[model samples]
Target: MKAMILAAGLGTRLRPLTLDRPKPLVDVHGRPLIEYNLLLLRRYGIVDVIINLHHQGDALRAALGSGDTLGVRIVYSPEDPLLDTGGAIKNAASLLGDDDFLVLNGDTIIDLPLDALLAAHRARRAAATLVLRHDPEQQRYGLVEIDGEERIRRFLGRPAEVETALVPYMFAGVHVLSSRVLDYMPDPGTTFSITRATYPAMLAADEGLYGFPFAGFWRVIDTAADLARANAILEERPPLHFL
Candidate 1:
């Protein structure tokens, strides 16, 4: 399957570490953070990759040229003015082709079972399946509430209807989306967020947007403290299986 890594963010929270290099290139235990993500995707047999680049985009392109040495074919979707999540994916639509594809946020690290997630997506016949986790601080992030069957009944920390009882779960920065889902997205140049715009729209339309709940090791490197914590975790439990 094809995959897209959203590596174009400014990473303002990363500060000095990102001042010299992009957040994807920031070292998280010896290797660049995005390298670990690429390696994990490679292990899952995702060979074709499209990475969106901005804020030192050229440097990232240079470092990961073609991804040949790493055994994956790399393609770039360079953004002159970086688009948000939905926009980036829409901009890369041609490269992604017309099929179901996986999207990953480059700053997050998670040990997700690809096969299971994909199977769940297919079985539920969902337009998109977001990987989710139970976090009490769901309000802080864009949260989703799933029904017994994992269909997202609520989004963005809001209840969809009167009958729906919201069950709190935070988005895990990973998604399996069908190409048809793009039809609901705004124009490529429009500043839209998949979490904020597309998914909510889908929910309102009664489309089957589900959540794949996974209880695994996951972290998002949004700030210096998060980076340090990821380094500590990697040092304590180096993921050999990922390699």
Candidate 2:
């Protein structure tokens, strides 16, 4: 299996900290944030990794060149004018090849049963399976509504209307995507969001887009406070099995 860490963001929210490095390179308890995701994928035996680079990208490359220290073989996709999620995936289509690959946010920490998520994705034969979790701030983060069968009835605000009594969940920024999804994406080099543009189109066409329910430790290290909170939480009791 292959994986891509969406690490190209300028991370405007992180401010001065990100002024020196990319969001994924920001320190979290003495370790770069992206290192956790790299180690997490390595733990699950997914070693082939692709990282899209933009802001302070050279620094990221300098810090973890070739991914040898991290136990993963990484290739970088350098984007001068950064591509959004969907565009990033499309940009690295050649590296990802023709298989189901994992996509995750570089600035977040999440610990869940990856095997179970993969099993569910295959069982459902979904075109894509996003990791969804209940968050009181679902609307704040963005609402990802799912039906009884776990089909994502709506993503963010896409498909604006739905009669079904959909349950809202927050997108964990992790997902398994089939190679065929590339068909639904814009032309290569185009900037677009997978959730905002691609997924909704797939949903409209009745393509299977499902959600994997996750109830585990998850945090988005976006702001300075978020970074601090993660460190505090981890310091109290190391819950991450990989650590």
Candidate 3:
């Protein structure tokens, strides 16, 4: 399976650091932030990666050229005007092909069980499966409600679904989506979000969307404080399991 790492954001919150390089290149531990993502993919045996670049696009290629040392083949999709999550994927549709592919946030760190996520995605036969996490700030991030069967019933509170006893979780910025999801996107070359635009439409159409509940280490590197927290955590407990 192929994976696409979403690394095109402006990283405006990161300020000075991002002013130097892209968010994915921000130093986390000894490797670039995106290197951890690459290592994780190679660890799970998914070596073909598509990284969408916009902010500091040249630095990404310069840092990891051909991906030989890292053991993964990278295909870059440069967005001149910048595409949102949904549109970015749509732009790279040719590289992803017909198979269901994985999308990951390039600036976030997560020790996701890729094999398990893949298995659950296939078993549920979902059109898309988002990795969900329980957090006090779930609402702050965005509320995603899932049924007892692990199927996503509401995305960011849309379609006006009845309230259920099921607990809501925040999106983990990692998901496996069928290529068919691209069909739900707007006109070609349009900038839109998969969660904000395509997802609600899919939910209204009754397309299967599920969630994989995760209770492991996950962190976002959007601000200096967030980066400091991640660095502190890594110093204390190294993820020996990940590559």
lDDT of 1 at 113: 88
Instruction: Tell me the spans in candidate 2 whose CA falls farther than 4 Å from its real position.
Output: 158-165
Candidate 2 lDDT, tens digit per residue, 127-235?
9999988875555464688888999877765333334465678788999999999999878899998888999899999999998989888889878888899899878
The lDDT values for all models are 0.88, 0.88, 0.88
lDDT per residue, candidate 1, 131-184, as tens digits?
Answer: 999765445567778888888887754322233356678888999999988998
The superposed Cα distance between candidate 3 and the true structure at residue 57, in angstroms, equals 0.4
Q: Candidate 3, residue 183: CA error in Å? A: 1.2
Give the count of colliding residue pairs in each prediction.
0, 0, 0
Give model 1's TM-score versus the native structure. Answer: 0.94
The ten-residue window of minimal lDDT in model 1 covers: 156-165
Tens-place lDDT digits, model 3, residues 28-141: 877799998899999999999999999999998899888999999999999979888888999999899999999998987888889999999999889999999997656556
Off by over 4 Å in 3: 157-166
Write down the lDDT that model 2 would get.
Answer: 0.88
TM-score of each: 0.94, 0.95, 0.95
**Reference-based lDDT, residue 69, model 1:** 95
